[model samples]
Target: MNYDDRRASPRYPLRAFAELGSSDREWAAHVLDISYYGARIALLDEYNLCAGDPIRLRLEIPEMQVPEGMLPYLHLEGTLVHQQEHMLGIQYEPASELDAELLKQILANLNK
Candidate 1:
């Protein structure tokens, strides 16, 4: 509950539906928490993720407030940084300006 001291960016708890992997091989995951640089997700299926595997994430949180010109989609190209059981820690690549702004907006809304 106290991730404030360690993370570069504050982590926000979010229960959002997400999709991982490429178009041909996608899996359902629930985003448990998110930050500017990384996220923790729970895989719905039994597939185990390997570290350093290139993956793409597509998250949708319909209830969260979104900034103007920003869609509800949160997409990122990331790598599996760590894993434990059914959960995964993904470190995202640098985001586009639009995505960065959108994430900031969502965090602000969540904090409120």
Candidate 2:
């Protein structure tokens, strides 16, 4: 994808495992494909997601998911953007200032 496009993007490939959550519902046991403002997460069996569904995310970074498996955890509030097969795509809500800044940097780097 072209980072210079008006669309938001990520700097580097962020590979991590994610657990999806929502008010009154939680789905765990899956890895997520993450970027700056969104993600495509693989769901475990028995989970059904749809467009317009709001969600929460927990991303476990590689180092955290392997070896000692710690740190780089992320808590995100987002909404479903799309879904295909077993993958659920989401767009993050603008919540924390820190997260917004970080996402901005990630996209900026992608332009380089």
Candidate 3:
């Protein structure tokens, strides 16, 4: 079976900037696509990452409007599931309610 067929939810293509951090390291990345369960990203620079490595991702979705006093970014925790050169597939861990709501809002805007 295809690897994508294992996904439980559909992915939405998103052209946005993001920061990916693990331990003391951080790298600039571009959001390729996202789903409720995970995301695929391309790093701006080459970096060695193995599957199952913990990663913290902060996505800056410029097209998504947010209410006053709210941040315009989404913070998420995930694990690197696959890698090919500078591109990586990440599987999200369980999210907080706030993060989950924000993800829903982002997806809604993307579907428009």
Candidate 4:
């Protein structure tokens, strides 16, 4: 099987504000879908950014599992790898142990 067939990912919609800089310049975007590894985003506005631009995207997720949670999504440093129209595909810059574990579980679930 190919890699895509071997790995399973979740597809969910998230409302978020994407910032280009540390300063609070934000843009509204929709989470097209997400795997534990990375995500595909559809931006509402047009942005002229190149590949390898380090960007931090705040993914807005609903808080229902815990009473007190800081943020729904983990902080990620993304490298722009692919782009098509308004959609962008990025790979996590440095995926941690937790991210790797979660991705493994997600892929296992998807294959099963």
Indicate which candidate wins on lDDT: 3
Error of 1 at 58 (Å): 0.6
Clashes of 4: 0
For candidate 1, write residues 12-54 as lDDT tens digits.
Answer: 8998898998535789999999888889999968775688888
Q: Backbone collision count in every prediction?
A: 0, 2, 0, 0
TM-score of each: 0.83, 0.66, 0.90, 0.58
Q: Which lDDT tens digits does candidate 3 get at residues 10-58?
A: 8999888999999879999999999888999999687877999999999
Candidate 3 overall lDDT versus native: 0.85
Residue-wise C-alpha lDDT for candidate 4, range 15-46, written one tens digit per residue: 44443322234556676666665677877686
The TM-score of candidate 3 is 0.90
How accurate locally, in lDDT, is each candidate? 0.80, 0.63, 0.85, 0.55
Residue pairs clashing in model 2 are 64-69, 64-70
Question: Cα deviation of 61 in candidate 3 (Å)?
Answer: 1.9
The residue pairs in collision within model 4 are none
Report the C-alpha lDDT of model 2 over 23-88, residue by residue, as the tens digit. Answer: 777777464445677766777666666799888887664552332332355567889877777777
TM-score head-to-head 2 vs 3, winner: 3
Give the per-residue Cα lDDT of candidate 1 at 79: 90
Give candidate 2's error at residue 44 in angstroms: 1.9
Give the CA lDDT, 0 to 100, for residue 109 in model 1. 79
